[model samples]
Target: GAGVSQSPSNKVTEKGKDVELRCDPISGHTALYWYRQSLGQGLEFLIYFQGNSAPDKSGLPSDRFSAERTGGSVSTLTIQRTQQEDSAVYLCASSLAYQSTDTQYFGPGTRLTVL
Candidate 1:
């Protein structure tokens, strides 16, 4: 059984450039999540997807951030007109069920550096 994984371990971009971070959740997991961690800060919830239900995106920082889960397996998080403040490590996680009490397995994360 594979654990959650992310791509492009690291990224460097101009301040206004856009970036896409990808994630692959473990098989049989029905709940997926996206989070961000700024340099020394704790993880910040960004979005969540559970089965066929609508995604929960209330945690997205602003309009520049968005994500999508395809086939209920892989997910991508995109940042439009990236800003210096958007520089952080983007993490992904998945759980066996949608319950808030379920344990989430985390990915290593994609680090984005906005210059």
Candidate 2:
């Protein structure tokens, strides 16, 4: 893809089920991030992966949420035991590196709806 892209633009899952969202970043970017946007909470960061370094998951709200980047390219965000509160637009972004000066490119986001 030319820029950051996400899969399954909209997902509707039942409560207690699990869901996985995918993000494909720019060809050579090294930094990837996951964020959640909801009516109750604005844009909230969930995790960050910079190169081969361990991902920074300090922003994750709960243990049920997890994400990973494979081969420094595609990334996946998994939500276990989904709840109504988990309904939100999951966003992904990538930058050249994990530097303050790097500009991040954002994806369209995956809208997850827990029923």
Candidate 3:
């Protein structure tokens, strides 16, 4: 009955540093997603994982961004050489399935600030 959760509610880092954000999706959910919201901007999809299918990395902004889901449960998003523009709230969501109409439960995001 637990909902999606994220760690390190806030993070501050210097430009060029690297950061890793973690997420735990709800039990029994088979689809997970990562998204980012910059200051004053809308949510931008980052990546998606569904069951054993290959992850969809199309939403990643650049090579500096990457993520992985293990055992179809926990997930981590890694940012390499963080940039000032990377400051944003990284959100994670999960659904029961990967259907387009399925409702996604969102997690409290991890806020990253790059100085």
Stretches > 4 Å off in candidate 3: none
lDDT of 3 by residue, 18-62 (tens): 999999999999999999999999999988999745457889999
The predicted structure with the larger lDDT, 1 or 3, is 3
Give the TM-score of each candidate: 0.95, 0.94, 0.95
Q: Look at candidate 2 and give me any clashing residue pairs.
A: none
Clashes of each: 0, 0, 0
Question: Model 2 TM-score?
Answer: 0.94
Off by over 4 Å in 2: none
Q: How well does candidate 1 match the true structure in TM-score terms?
A: 0.95
The TM-score obtained by model 3 is 0.95
lDDT of 3 at 76: 91
Give the per-residue lDDT digits (tens) of candidate 1, residues 1-115.
7899999899999999989999999999999998999999999999898964545678999999988887878888999999999999999999999997989999999999999
Please give the CA lDDT of all the candidate structures.
Answer: 0.91, 0.91, 0.93
